[model samples]
Target: MVNETMVTFQGWIGTDVTDRYVGEAVVASFRVASTPRKYNKLANGWVDGETNWYTVNAWRSLGRNCMEALKKGDAVVVHGRLSTQVYEDEEKRRFQTMVVEATSVGHDLNKGTSFFTKTTVGAGGEADDGALREFNAELGIGGPQISSDGQALGDFVTDEPSKEPAA
Candidate 1:
């Protein structure tokens, strides 16, 4: 038997990411501040409630990428699993802590502009590839017709048109 789990948490980074190497794989760890609100009916208003701090850990390529891009105070959306562990200190006092094992992480839009790089993968229809190739060629990114498993699509294009009177 097997069980699968998924969890999403949105919060601001409480500190800069710390990166280290375990054997050959690189890992990054950081803490995030999450504020959950509560409604106070008696006061007839919403209360600025307690803030929970969560530690997030990312491994391998993701860790390296995050170390370069993520920073303190950056709002991020993290998808992963929750883990808790208990241990006894030297004084024999017991304590338990919770942390998240982040699989995929990205900056939340409220923090900054979102940049998306589109890439087409798998074996789609020939027509689709042809059209993609035409667009890619016109845009000068290898005529999207042919693509490897991890080939980069192209540059980012803005949907917003120039601000001017249409002739």
Candidate 2:
């Protein structure tokens, strides 16, 4: 959908990311609130304008990462396609809601600092075992498997499938 609109919001996470299984796929959903502020020169301070709330959803690996990394009140930037839903309440009043199917979500650097961990992707595919092993190594699995020569840990990992998992 080349015509799909791309939107980004700088906001605070309004809710902790909730992970659930939709069939076999994992999805993480959270809410974010973006409020505008204006300087009140006469008052010698800044005043809050309007606040907009959005629901953000991430799927698959991104969803899993969000579940692991995001918490309520964290400042973040969400980038995704803008989507909407309309429904009527029991009283027959119509209401519209907005959501973003996030392609990427990260902590807003303007508010504070954040550390990033690179996710491993293999030449074959994201589901490949090589990528999974690399991801585990990046987390320092097995308490640093450094060789005597001080080579980088996980250098011994190979694409070959082992008959038995390492103990």
Candidate 3:
């Protein structure tokens, strides 16, 4: 990919994620919209600029995770290879779009908080409960009680309750 264009985008998910299988490989596609803002000294406020939209495609495990974790309106950051795709309609009109073949995609931490869960894939390329248990043991915590679908059934333990000033 020496000649490929690489870019990182920060934006809000503009559409619902579409997950589909092309043969044995899964791909998840979605639209992201990024709008720029600039401070206007004369206007004494910030001005909104035109939004740029990009189509993002995540492949394989990333695609599956995206399908489960992402939704419209969520703020996210995507890093990937960028390219333009052109298509001709039946009427011979041409349409062009910017696409990102995402290498990594995640929620924007500045917008909100997120919980992290490590997914361990076994030899057969499936979630491994045993591996999760081992990981939990290494962390000196009780083994995570996982459901058949791989979701943690045990409640998360927090160090302390949030101490905020009384309103």
Highest-scoring model, TM-score: 3
Number of clashes recorded per candidate:
1, 0, 0
Error of 3 at 66 (Å): 0.6
Candidate 1 C-alpha RMSD relative to the actual structure: 9.6
**TM-score, cand. 2 vs. native:** 0.69
How many Å off is the CA of 129 in candidate 2?
7.8
Worst 10 residues of 3 by lDDT: 139-148
Off by over 4 Å in 2: 41-44, 121-167
Best by lDDT: 3
lDDT of 2 by residue, 49-127 (tens): 8999998989988897888789999999999999897999999999998889999999999999998765543453243
Best-to-worst ranking by lDDT: 3, 2, 1
Q: What's the C-alpha lDDT at position 53 in model 1?
A: 81
Q: Give the alpha-carbon lDDT of every model.
A: 0.75, 0.81, 0.86
Alpha-carbon lDDT of model 2: 0.81
How does each model score on TM-score?
0.66, 0.69, 0.76
Worst-scoring 10-residue span by lDDT in model 2:
141-150
129, model 1: CA deviation in Å? 22
Q: Work out how many backbone clashes candidate 2 has.
A: 0
Q: Rank the candidates by TM-score, best first.
A: 3, 2, 1
